[model samples]
Target: MNNLDKVKKIVIEKPLKLDCGKTISNFPLAYETYGKLNEKKDNAILAFHALTGDQFVTGINPITNKNGWWSYLVGPDKPVDTNKFFVICANVIGGCIGSYGPNTIDPITKKKLATNFPVITINDMVNAQINLIDFFKIDKLFSVMGGSMGGMQVLQFVANFPNRTKTAIPIACTASHSAQNIALNELGRQAIMADVNWNKGDYLNSECSPDKGLSVARMAAHITYLSKKGLQEKFGRKLQERDDLKFSFDADFQIESYLRHQGSVFVDRFDANSYLYITRAMDYFDLVKQYNGNLSNAFKESKAKFFIISFTSDWLYPTSENKEIVIALNAAGANVGFIEINSDKGHDSFLLDVPEFLKSIKNFLDANYKIL
Candidate 1:
């Protein structure tokens, strides 16, 4: 095959013991690949996805009929440059889009796992990925890159497989969530549980699903993805259709309409129980604690080149928070590069049409990946 480009559904037979003392014998993972692995097996790169993202990192998404989420950065001539490296993106263990989550069929019961699914952590997620990487027969990944929750996985990969990753790029995320972010996630879950049709995460057994609750949750979480300046610049308290206030509770402002649309469309695609499982995984991701409260020790064995990026207006994961990681990397005496791009787009800037950010990524990937 000129390009090993396709989605692969794989199952690991060996039991993987999670950090929480739980063990799973057969874990399923969904992954997509692009370009071809060199005969030397040194050109493979694994790209992690954000909280709601899937393994469809490039090309057309069959379900959505839209371009892959990271198409801007991962195509043949794009920043990641598939012409040079083989890229693989795997859906996280607790994700719903074809991965083993609440929606997966439980062999024992012959039914969906639902609330019965095992609680997964970021460490568990990376463990599953390590299995997938082993299946690909690659001794080491050339680089691993991701942003937001995906970025959390990148750090987890480095922490757990220090020698396996040659280059690590974590962008727009913290090693752990702040109390405030945890609170926001809690609010989303509460919204879902409050719906009568939730049925405590077993809604699949019933005719009713918590569509409304899930929509509200998505609406709430979507706001944190943008900057205050971005919100003002895009909507700015502007009235929707009438150009004047509607006295009733209808969506009078453009931002309200925008959020409602986002929520509605999200509910059509995502499942409520899957949302709960994945968000809980993100909340429990704490790298420093995994290394006994010393963040530097987490990277003690990391020989990978590190390039960390953050956005200036991203309050969700502000530059100061990202610098904590950079400082820790320095303490570990690792090769690292840190940059905070000045942007009004906030945390979503990495996904948007930011020229400077894209340029920086292109430069970083080009410099870090040297042909062996």
Candidate 2:
């Protein structure tokens, strides 16, 4: 393959420290890049993926045959404009795609780690990202952006490597995982564990996949991504096909059918154990609590210009939480711009085609991230 068409992969063969007191070796990360790095190598943008997201950010997903998740905003002439900036996105650690995760082979046992893989925290994922950045010989990122769990990673990156990023955009996220967030994740985990097919996370050797369990988990979590208003507008007591109820145990309403479809399709491209590990990593994320419960102290050293967005209808990561981060940044004396986007798209507004959100992102990048 030509240099421009290269598929990027990085291997950390040496032991790396983790916040959980465990050291990992031979950690592999699969990433994708768009545009090109210039002579100065300072035009790179690092994008972090959400819980179930992989490395494909702006290309056709080989397995799903669908456009990249954020293709609307990351391509040439788009909001961030890949034609102007070199964009890099890696599948986070504890993810199933081409990256190190619970389903991968363990060098020591010569078998898939399955349930044996050591638990990882969000900080550990950022540490792995640092290695990938170092391998590419990039000293500073032009910008870093993401939403939901992706947003959490962006916050951690700016906090940990303050001066390394010129700008930070974290949408629909908080500086730390709220107690309600942990509860929601726990609900999904329970649904997975309750499925008999899970077989205690050892389904790999048994040659039996936990499709039902994983599907149920995805179904439960998908509901949290939308707002009550959005849900009502989309499928409020609407019947599936016929006007009358089936009077059976099958999907009776439109909402039920949608959730089932989401669950089934998710299991096709995602692993059950990987979901467990990733959600666990998110649940353990609490930046302020980690720094003695002081929000100001958490972002005191951040030098990146901040632009935070939140949806008015997003109950998962409400507008209030987004402003809390901005308030702390203000106290820390960080350059910041924030707006509460008026949208009914809920926490998934950042992923949807919201004109206001797009305009705001484009204007922010144009102002803060200058491409020369």
Which regions of candidate 1 are displaced past 4 Å?
A: 1-7
For residues 1-372, write the lDDT of model 1, one tens digit per residue. Answer: 111224478988889897678888777788889999999888899999988788889888765667888988888998888998899999898887777889888887888899998889988999998988999899989999999998999999999899898899999989878898899899999999999999888897777889999999999898999988999999998998996786999999999999999999887677899889889999998888888898999999989999999999899888988899999999999889999998999888878778888888889877766642
TM-score of each: 0.96, 0.96
**Residue-by-residue lDDT tens digits, candidate 2, 209-324:** 88888898899888989888999999999999877998898899999999999999999888889999999999999888877877777678877888999999999999999998
Model 2 alpha-carbon drift over 4 Å, by segment: 1-7
Number of clashes recorded per candidate: 0, 0
Candidate 2, residue 238: Cα displacement in angstroms equals 1.9
When summed lDDT is taken over every stretch of 10 residues in candidate 1, the lowest stretch is 1-10
- Candidate 2 residue-wise lDDT at 64: 70
Residue 50 displacement in candidate 1 (angstroms): 0.9
